[model samples]
Target: MNRFRQFMSGRYGFDQFSQGLVILSLVISLIGTLTRSNILITVSYIPFIYAIYRILSKDINKRMKENYQYTMFINTVKGKFLKGKRNVTGTKTHKYYTCPKCKTTIRVPRGKGKICITCPKCRTEFIKRT
Candidate 1:
């Protein structure tokens, strides 16, 4: 245990990106196994190997940056999905529109016909039927 700790002292170790890669590898391996595909089983090693490489890498800054980017990408995807969920849930009660100038989403109450909508972010006005 002590020797392993010493060996890993300068290594980047496990992180979110590494964990994701490992999970992806396992999922691919499972699918490959179910289908009995030799090619897919071989392909599953790619992520697992890269994850091991990342875990053993000594470049801390580069590993941190990679993790940061991966997290940011995940956050953006989650945000979009949540936004879409909200829009779907609010479809009957509220109307959703994107601001032309700032590209911000504006939510307003429905049934107000031919109203001029003002963007809260950019103050741009556009007429839309509700």
Candidate 2:
């Protein structure tokens, strides 16, 4: 009993933001289920299950051993949660926009207008309004 409490209190190095996201998703799912809304239930369950899976995931080693591809996917998801945003590659000096393709928030120059923006992750190109 005491050990369990201590373990819960001790920092397991799990991302708090992701934990919160999972909780939020579960709550929404519960609400959807109670309300009998199939659409909400289905959509909410995706994040809910994902959040639970991420929270229960022990570490990179276990994740890698279980499945490298899935480990990478979870790591990417964890990165987004920990960083509070997705990865973005662009000039540091310029203002940036989020890449529509990969959802990576990019940085671009302040006054750059009609500039072509490319996402490093998905390699999608689009114009940024700056």
Top candidate when judged by lDDT against the true structure: 1
> For each candidate, how many residue pairs have backbone atoms clashing (under 3 Å)?
0, 6
| Leading candidate by TM-score | 1
The digit string of per-residue lDDT tens for model 1 on 1-130 reads: 9999999999999999999999999999999999999899999999999999999999999999999999999999999999999999999999999988899999989998889999988899999888
**Residue 17 C-alpha lDDT in model 2:** 43
Q: Which regions of candidate 1 deviate over 4 angstroms?
A: none
Worst 10 residues of 2 by lDDT: 84-93
lDDT of each: 0.96, 0.65
What does candidate 2 score on TM?
0.30
Q: lDDT score, residue 128, model 2?
A: 65
